[model samples]
Target: MTVRVRLFAGAAEAIGQDEVTLADVTTLGDLVARLVADFGSGVAPVLDRCSFLVDGVRAADAETRVTGTVDVLPPFAGG
Candidate 1:
């Protein structure tokens, strides 16, 4: 199966793409590891700071099963 990841803010800039498709990634941890492997270590920090939305719902933890679309959103700043 394939999972689609949508990056936002720093996460998008770090990977140089707003969206990517990954294979063989069944959980959030797997997806994060794959991204770091594919995109290089530079993306790790961004991923660390990101909050994930799995198919439009906030992921509870790294073990969260992932499918469909995953949205990677970095912390936002506003006042």
Candidate 2:
């Protein structure tokens, strides 16, 4: 299944886009690896502090299965 990922905050800047698609079911960590590879190590530090949401609800684990639309949310610095 293809999953859509929406990037937010520093992630969006690192990725240079707000959205992307993955071709199969992947863990959040796997997806992050891909993103870091594609974008650059500049995203790595931010990614370490990032969180994920699968279709809106927070994903508590990096091993969490992501099969559908997901959001890659980097740490936000503002109120």
For candidate 2, which ten residues in a row score worst on lDDT?
22-31
The sequence of per-residue lDDT tens digits that candidate 1 reaches over residues 1-79 is: 7999999989999999999999999999999999999999999998999999999999999999999999999999998
Clashing pairs in 1: none
Positional deviation of 74 in candidate 2, in angstroms?
2.1
Q: Which candidate number has the best TM-score?
A: 1
List candidate 1 stretches off by more than 4 Å.
none
Q: What is the C-alpha lDDT profile of model 2 across 1-79, one tens digit per residue?
A: 6889998877888788989987755888788887778788888888788888987889988798787888888766778
For candidate 1, the TM-score is 0.97
Q: Which portions of model 2 show Cα errors greater than 4 Å?
A: none
